[model samples]
Every structure is written in C-alpha cells, then in structure tokens.
Target: MGRILLTGASGFVGGAIHEYLSNSSTHKLTVALRRPMSSLPVTTTLAQIDQIDGVTDWSRALLDSDVVIHAAARVHVMQESSTDPLTSFRKVNVEGTLNLARQAAEKGVRRFIFISSIKVNGEETSLGVPYTACAEPAPADPYGISKMEAEKGLMRIASESGMEVVIIRPPLVYGPGVKANFFNMMKWLYRGVPLPFGAICNSRSLVALDNLVDFVVTCIDHPKAANQVFLVSDGDDLSTTELLKKMGRALGKPARLLPVPSGVLTLAATLLGKKTLSQRLCGSLQVDITKNRELLNWLPPVTVETELDAVAKDFLDKHV
Candidate 1:
C-alpha cells in the first residue's frame, strides 16, 4: 500500500477522494486540515502548516508519502468580500500550495496531483468549440486566476524538484453529496415549480462524484499521468432541461418545465440582475477529453443519467 497526503479533507471533493481511496487496500491516505473538521468517513486532527517563509515544516508530511493531492483551495464565494480577492486566493491557493509542494519535494514524494478547475479557461462555454486541456488559461474570476497562477508556480517547482506534477482540470461535477447550484436545482425541482429552461439547448460537461474519484486514483499510478495535464468528464453532455428531467425521475417526481423561449428568460433574468443564473443554465460549456482518452486509455464508468438519478434519490431521502 502506498501512503498519500491530501489537503481539504472535509470538503465535498476532498471527502469523496478520502472515502474512495480509503476503501482500497493498496492506498494509505492522510488528510490535512487547518483545524478539526468532522462528519468525514476518515480520521483527522489538527496539523501544522506554514503560513509563510523560506522555511517550513511541511516536508515532514511528505516523509514516506507516495503522492500529494493538493485539493485544498480558497473557494470563490467563501472569500468573495475580502478587500483583495486575488490576494486572498493567492494566500491560500498559491502560497499554501507552494508550502505543501516544497515539503513534498524535500521528502521525495513521488507524485504531486493538483485538483484545478476548468474555470482557469473561462466560466462560460463557447459556441463553436469546447475547452481543451491545452487552452491558454484566461480565468475571469479571482478563483480561476489563482488556479492558473498556481499551475505556473507548480510547473516551476516540478522542474527544479524530481516530483512529478499532474494537473487534472475538471468541469462542473455533480452527484450525491453535491452542493452549490446543483443542490439548488434539486430544491427547486422538488418544489414542483415550473422551470423555464426547456428551450435552452446549451451543453455542459459534468463529472459524477464516483467517476471523478475513480479518475484521480487512476492518475496516482498511471505512468502517463506524470508531468501531464488532463481533463476528465463522463464523456457525455446534458442540457439544463434534460438534467431536470433526469433528476425528477430519480426523485420520483415529474419535471415541470415550461416551454418558454430562451431569449425571453434571458430578458427577464437581465431585468432582475439574475444574469449569472441565466448564463449558467444556457451556457454551452463542454470539455474535450480526447487527450485523456488517447493518453490514459480511460473513460468514466458512471453515466450522467445514472449520476443525476442517484442525486435526486439522495436528495429526497434527506429532505423527505
């Protein structure tokens, strides 16, 4: 069994990775948290992390560790109101990452896996082409800018150190234990309120929790994953209306979609400053995983339909 150190063990993506890797007899995992975080399947306690300096104690965590998955990041909304969003993100995302990575390098950690978001490219999807792994990062928000900058920093670190850096930039992820907009959608759908996204035909790439966990573990051992940037998804696209319908079926409810035109909804949302919500639903943000397929010879095991169904059922079970 190989020992791995993970950060952000208490969050949604972090929790999923911990649970998934813990089940494997070949992997021994340690999660690092700033303080005590509960409601996790794994055991954890307070640990020391250097907030700054040319010196740090993080190398200790890297001792005998096989891989370091830096899942911890300053999420956008969590630190939105700060005076300098970019600087705040840098403090946690960039500086914190270097602290951990430098330690891993000193201690001879084999692989450094970073969980970066597709937002580094852009938040909205384009009409002609989907985002690819090679696309130049043009993050419009603070979160995206921080991640893109960190990628550069890690690259420099990897060149100097022997540790291999693997970057996996994934699009929107949804499934059981999902939060954010997907969770909000579930709540709206359960209320049987008619949604006006029926006419929107934008496509989005979504990865299920199970599928994302599987991909990350695969990268840990895959010889091709080293010094590589990869993009992963369920290899299928789903529209907003289709997603609602699938979710409804999983919850044993009917999708109440109104056949309103997309343009009309856009106008209404614009008037109310609900532009963000409208863009999210009607955005054609898709990711091209051709490189992932060719390089890793891997495809997601779970389908979007099955994943949405699971989410719906889980939501109802919790709320009902």
Candidate 2:
C-alpha cells in the first residue's frame, strides 16, 4: 500500500474524504490539518500545518507520500470583508495549492488529485447544454477565477515534472453533515414549510459526497485519469421543483410548494438584495459526465435518492 497525503482533512468536503481514506487499508493516509481533531482513525497520521497560504511549508508532509489529494481551499464566503476578494482567494487557493503541488513533485509524489468547483466554467448553464471538460473557462467570480488559475498552474507543473495531475470539478455536493443552503432546504422540507419554488423549472447537477470520494480514490491509481480534467455529478439531473419534492419525500413530508410565478420570486429577491440566491434556485447548472463514464467507466456508487435519504435522516437526528 502506498502513502497518500490529504490536505484539508477537517473541513466539510475534506472531512468526508478523510473519513473515507482513513477507513481504507489500501493506502496509508497522512492528513494535513490546521489543528488536530479528537476522532481521527488510529491508522492515520496527523500532520498539522498552521495555515495554508502562499508561504506554508509542505516539504515534510510530502516526503514518502505517493499521492497528494488536495481538497483544501478558501471556498466561497457569504460575507467576505477582504478588500480584494480575488487576491485573498488566490493567496490560499492558487498560491498555496501550487506551492504544495510543486513541492510534492520535487518530493517524487506520483499523482496529485485536486478537488475543484464547477464555478470555474461559470455559475449557470443554458438549458439542455451541460458544462463539459473542454468548455472554454468563463469563471464568473473571484473564487472560480482562483480555481481556474490553480488548474493552469498545476497543469504547468505536471508538464515540467513527471507527476500526474488529475482535476475533478464537482457541482453542489450534498450528503450527511451538509450545511448552508442544502441543510436549510432539508430543514424546511422536514418541517413541511411551504416554499415558493414550484414554478422554477431549472435543472441542476449535484454530486453525493460518497460518489465524489469514490472517484477521488479511483483517480489515485487510475492511469486514464492522469492529466485530465473531469466534471462530475450523480448522473441524475433534477429540476428545483423535483429536488424539493424528492427532499420532501425523503423527509416523509408533503412537498408543500406554492406555485408562485418565477418572475414574482425574482422580483421579490431583487427588492430584498437576494438576487443571487433567487438565481441559484431558478437557474440551470448541469454538467456532462460522459468523459468520466466513457473513459474511466466510473459510475456514482451512491444514488441521489439514497444520499437524499441520508441527508434527511441526519437533519432529523440533529433537530430531535
């Protein structure tokens, strides 16, 4: 078994990846964290890195590590006080990521798997047209731009060195311990709260946490995944109305949706300075996973329905 170095092991998505890696005996896992946690598996090594930024040293952690799975980054913040959001994002996401990758290459790490976001292609997709790996990048926000830049930098490092680089761009990821909008949606669905999204006909592609980890584990050794960018989803696209209805069913509650006009909802959101939130609910953001399926023959191990049930169960447990 080879050694795998995982960064951002204590974060939301990273925490899930850490759990998955720690349980597996296939690879000896070394987790890089800002601070130690109490419940990490006994087999895993905890390497504390004070902060991940432009100058954070990673030489010690990369030594003897066969693969580097980089799941750490400065994700989108709701209320960022930084004067320059792009600069702040670049500091951690771009600069810190490249520094680690370069050091890993120097230290003879065979493969580097980077978990990126679909925002690199833009926030919304046109109806029936899903984002693909070959799409011309049109990053809409500072966070997306930073990820795009990091992708380019990693590819350059891969070219100069022999280290194989794999990039996976995932859409909204949801599962147990999901927070933010998905968590709120589950709570509202569980309580049977009436939502005004019945008329919004937008298709979104989301990935279950398990499915993402499965793919990342596969890429750790898959030869075909090297030097390629992949856009991943659950292979199940659903409209906003369909999502809420399924969520309600998972929660054992009525969908309870009011058929409000999409225009009215958008206008109200605009008046309340929540245009982006409304657009997220009313917009289409689908990704084509044809490459992942055809090349790697990778199918999502967990179904969306199964993951939705897990989310509902977790929410109920917390509320109770």
Candidate 3:
C-alpha cells in the first residue's frame, strides 16, 4: 500500500473520497486541512495549513507521500464582486496547485491527481456533439481559464520532473450530501414545485459522487492513467425534463412541470440577470468518456436511478 496525501478532506467530494479510502486497505491516507477537524473518516495524519494560496508551504506535507489528490479549488461564484476575479481564482486554484505539485515532485512523489471541472471545455455544448477527451479546450469563464492554466502548468511540471500527473474533469456530481443546484432541484421536486423544464430537451451528462470517488482512487495506482486528461460522467445522458421526472419518481411526487418555450425562458432570465442559470437549464452539455473506458476499463459503478433514489431517501430522512 502506498502513502497518499489528499487535500480538501472536509469538502463534499473530498469527504466522500476520504471515507472510501478510509474503508479500504489498499492505501494509507493523510489529509491536509485548513483547520483542525474532529471525527475524520480515515485514520490519517493531519497537516494543518492556513490556506491554499500562492504562498502556502506544502513541503512538510509532502515528506513521505506517494501520491497527491488535489480536490480543493475556488469554485465559480454567481456574483463575484472582486475587482480581479481571475487573479483571485489563480491565487488559490493555479498557484496553490502548482506549489503542491512542485513540493510533491521534490519529495519523490509518484503521481498527482487533479480534480477539475468540465467547464474547462465550455459552459454548454452544441446539440448532439458531446465533448471528448481530445477536444481543444475552449474555456469561457475565469474559473475555467484558471483550471486550464493549472492543467498546463502541471503538464509542464510533469515533463520536467518525471512525476505522473492525472487530470480528471467531471461534470455535475450529485448524491446524498450534494448541495447547490442539484440539492435545490431535489428540494423543489420533493415539495412538488412546478417547474418550466418540460420543453427543455437539452442533454446533460452528470456523474454520481460514488463514481467520481471510485475513478479518483483508481487513478492513484493505474498505469494507464499517468499523464492523461480524462472526462468522466455517469455513462448515461438525460434531458432536463427526464431528469426532473426521475427525481419526482424518486421523491414519490408528480413532476409538476409546465411546457414553456425555451426562448421565453431565456428572455425572462436575461431580464432578471440570471441568464447563465437559464442557459444551464436550456442548453446541452454532454461529455463522452470513451477514452477512459477503453483505456482504463473503468465504468461507473452506480446508476443514475439508484443514486437519485438514495438522494431522495436521504433528503426525506433528514427533513421528516
């Protein structure tokens, strides 16, 4: 078993990874936290750091690590009032990631696995043409640009230092403890709130929390994952209306959906300054994971239906 160092142990995705690694006997895990945390899932050595910024020192944390899985990043904010949003994102996502990679390489670490977003491709996709691993990057937003730059820097570092770097770009991940848009959708479905997604025939690719964590753990030791960029999903694509209907079934409620024109929805959101959210609902964003499956022989272990039921059950268990 190899010694692994994981960042972002307290966050949603990281917490899932930590729990899975803790339950397994394949690797010894250590987690770096911004503050002291109690009742961690794994029996791991803790390294305390103030923040993951440009100047954060990660030398001590890299002392005896074999692999580094970076799961922490400054996610995109809807209304970022910062004067320089790109610079702020770079400080934590790009600079901080490079700092950790450099330290790990110096300490003889074998691999670095970076958790990236599918936004690196673009916010939306054209109908029927899903993003592939070989697609040229077209990062539109500042957050995507920062992740793209970080990926480039990691590649350069790997070429120079001979440390294997694996980059996995995942679409929206949802499960029992999910938050943000996915969580909001679950809540609305449970409450039987009417939605205007009946006419939104846009396909979206999403990954389950367990599937993402499973792929990440596999990358830690997989020979074919070395120095590669992969796009991961649940291996099933669904339209917006279909997703909501499935969610309603899981919650034991009828999908109270109204058939609304996509144009009208976009115009209304534009007037309300929520154009991005509307686009996300109306536009297609699918990813093709053929390369990962063919190369690594990996498939998502959990189906979307099973995960949605799990999420619905958890929501009811908490609220009822």
| Candidate topping lDDT | 2
| Better candidate number, 1 or 2, judged by lDDT | 2
Candidate 3 regions off by >4 Å?
none
| lDDT tens per residue, model 3, 1-320 | 78889999889899899888888787888889988777764557788888998778888777689999999898887789889999999999999999989888989999999999998999999888999988999999999999999999999999999999999999888898787888888888778889988888889999999899989988989999999999999999998899999989998987999999889999999999999999888889999999989999999999999999998898889875
State how far residue 168 of model 3 sits from its true place (Å).
0.5
Q: Residue 21's C-alpha lDDT in candidate 2?
A: 84
Computed on alpha carbons, the lDDT of every model, listed in order, comes to 0.81, 0.92, 0.90
Q: Model 1 over residues 222-316: C-alpha lDDT tens digits?
A: 99989988878888888888888888877777879998887888889899888877888887888888988899988898988788878877788
lDDT comparing candidate 3 with the true structure: 0.90
lDDT score of residue 295 within candidate 1: 93
Of the pair 2 and 3, which is ahead by TM-score?
2
User: Can you give the lDDT of residue 202 in candidate 2?
Assistant: 84
Between prediction 1 and prediction 2, the one with superior TM-score is 2
Candidate 2 off by > 4 Å: none
Cα miss at 65, model 1 (Å)?
0.9
Model 1: lDDT of residue 314: 79
Alpha-carbon error at 273 in model 2, in Å? 1.4
